[model samples]
Target: LDGRTVLVTGGAGFIGSHLVDALCEGCDVRVLDDLSTGRRDHVHPEATLFEGDLCDEGVLDAATEDVDVVFHEAANASVARSVAAPRASHRTNATGTLAVLEAARRADARVVAASSTAIYGDPTTVPVTESEPTTPLSPYGVEKLAADHYVRLYADLYGLDTVALRYFNVYGPRQACTDYSSVITTFLEQACSGQPITVEGDGDQRRDFVHVRDVVSANLLAATTDRVGEAYNVGTGDSVSVAELAALVVELTGARSDVVSVDPRPGDITVSRADISKARAELGYEPSVSLREGLTQLVVGD
Candidate 1:
């Protein structure tokens, strides 16, 4: 990305901010975020910030101008919020993605967009591959699927260069600790606060939690690779149950908090492990961070 002009929508958010920080050293990075769920302070000092709604035509126009590549990360990312307000989510996740595609095409720039594993819903198999049929459960999942398909379609139909990354559960610093936050963030907050660590369901539900740094690496690889019009699963190719994760958190944090089971969220996937062989072969992507190391950093860094 050296000497390249890049635009990162949602660059103030967790994953996007990290991407911005990585690109700022060698590329002309411009961040476009609405601040709805993103923090202004998270954006890198070297990058320029364009604060506006992604669906706004004028905002998209200004953000994409003169850009060589665009990382489309802006979206209404909450599943619960999307379930409650599907229309609003559609406008952002689905329609907003189309706007970005059009802008990237107009700018004659390549596009790499963020996708979600939620598009697979509860997978029928253990390690979900890219070829698996999409069976989204929530409105957020549906919208993300729509966005993912639109990106690949634009590449084929308009001859635009585009790639979509179907990211698994991504966790790292700058990830917000909220009711809707990732399980890792929530567990960390609870453990640090000396509160009971809550585990949804029987705690046997498994997930592939990839670190933000690895996800950033995947993005960088996607941008430079000739693998266009295809989607790749970005993950560690490993899975862990919620019960195991909670135990590890307690051990790492050394918190005197009890681990308790709670009601599971409806339609939660029982198991999710990424089949990243395609990413390895095509994008040359590899995950370097271990779950234990990632948790230790969060606990000790705090």
Candidate 2:
């Protein structure tokens, strides 16, 4: 990616910032983020940061101009938040993505999208594959599904080089530990602060918690890989129950916090794991950091 110009949408946010940190090292990087959830400080100083909404035509124009690649990470990522507000999510996740595709088309740049495993909803099969049926049970899932289609549609219609990555439960440092954040972030926050680690439902719900760094690697790979018009599932190909994850966080943080059971909220999935065979074979992607290692680093770093 050296000497190539790149655009990272939402490059001030958790996942996007990580991409910026890597891309800015070799590429002339430009970032477009509204800062609704992203922080200006998170963006690398070397990259050009454009603060504006994706709905603005000028902002999207500036972002994609002369770009070699477009990494579309900006989205309303929370399922619960999407449930509370569907239209807004649709506008951003679906419409915003379409606008980005059009911008990339004009720039003649390859596109790499940060999609989600949520499109799988409650998969009937464990270790869901890319071939699995997309049964989005929530508004967020539906929005992502719609966006995923746009990526494929643009690629087929306009010969746009594109790859969509369906990421599993990604967590790491810099992730917000709020109610809308990932469960790992929330659990770690509670454990560190001595707050009761609330377990929704029976704490039996499983997730394939992939590290943010792994996700970053996959995005970069997708950007440069010759594989176009394809969407690969990004995950560790492992599953851990929420109870086990909470216990691990408690152990790592060494906080005097107790795990408590609670009722499950809406938009909850029973289990999730990814079959990353395609990514490994095609992208040479490997999960280097184990859950324990990643959690330890995140907890001890702060």
List the global CA lDDT of all models.
0.93, 0.90
lDDT of candidate 1 at residue 132, scale 0 to 100: 87
What is the RMSD, in Å, between candidate 2 and the native fold over all Cα?
1.1
lDDT by residue for model 1 (1-302), tens: 89999999999998999999999989999999999999999999999999999889898999899999999999887888898899999999999999999999999999999999999988988799999889999999999999999999998999999999999999999998653438899999899999999999999998999999999999999998998999999999999999999999999999999999999888777999999999999999999999999989988984
User: Cα deviation of 298 in candidate 1 (Å)?
Assistant: 0.7
Write candidate 2's Cα lDDT for 1-302 as tens digits.
Answer: 99999999989888999999999778999999999889999999999998988778888998888999999999988777788899998999999999999889989999999899988889989889998999999889999999998998888889999999999989888887554348888887788778999999898888898999999999988988888898999999999999999899988888889999988877678889999999999998898879999999998894
TM-scores for the candidates: 0.98, 0.98
lDDT of 2: 0.90
Q: What is the TM-score (0 to 1) of candidate 2?
A: 0.98
lDDT of 1: 0.93
